[model samples]
Target: MTPDSLSRRQLLTLTGSAAAAAALASLSLTGCSDRYKLRCQHQRTGEVYRELNIEIGSVITHSWIHSIELSRWTDIYRFDGETLMLTSTEFEAYGAGMPLDEGDVSVQDGQVVIENIDREFEAIRWIHSHRVDYRIGVDGDESLIDTDALPDLEPLELRPK
Candidate 1:
């Protein structure tokens, strides 16, 4: 084949290779069980907290997590797996902010716990504070998920935050 013809064939092969690589990249992400979103509520106070969206690929399933946030209310001093993060604005108002004096956030036995409990300012703090963890899954059951679920979403009416 002529030089120009050879170059055209090489270009086509490279294009196909690139397309295959891209497809494989996306497929690998889908195959991994590490990424998903969760909706949870606090068993106590019947308060709700929606964690909007969380990409857990980088977060360990059962590990201590240190977070920094700016807020006047709902100072989330600590959290365990049991402690749920609000998924939306509505639920956030209901779940309430974690107490500040409680101490550092920590994960224990696959659960998250906040030390202090300042019921008096929870509500007000939730609205003002930028950090909070007090929502629970409606069924209180955890599910391995590939897609985000909104139990509080319309139609299903899973839970009223």
Candidate 2:
């Protein structure tokens, strides 16, 4: 073969090798190329849950309604490079003979905070009512919740199969 042809072949091989190496480097930086399956279940009712299959740098929201009470639950999460962080979650339930409940949970500084309110009838004639509120912070954050911005329960983690 001509020298020129030989030189061109060597250049092509080098270029292909460089491309493959770059791709492998990218895969290594991403840790795992496979998508992870994430799941979070209700704290009270184990039957209610949210599931997602996702990869790093992905955001997902899963919601479902209780089969019997028609209560709703929604969870939003974002997968950072290392962990899946909870952004927000909400649960609301209203039914006969049950207290009207609303709950919210949010993440702040790598910790989770929760606020909830329950309302129920105080008398048989429905002439009186009562409300109870709760605020909780998890993950070593002791800061009190802002009463005005009280928001909504389950924590979720993503795992590789």
Winning candidate number (TM-score): 2
Query: Deviation in angstroms for 44 in model 2?
Result: 18
lDDT (C-alpha) at residue 101 in model 1 = 50
Estimate the lDDT of model 2: 0.39
lDDT of 1 by residue, 102-155 (tens): 434455543344433422211212211112322222222224321133222212
TM-score of structure candidate 2: 0.29
TM-score of candidate 1 relative to the true fold: 0.20
Q: Candidate 2 lDDT, tens digit per residue, 62-113?
A: 3445446445444444555455455655555433543233445455544333
The stretch of ten residues in a row with the least summed lDDT in candidate 2 is 121-130
lDDT computed for candidate 1: 0.30
lDDT of each: 0.30, 0.39
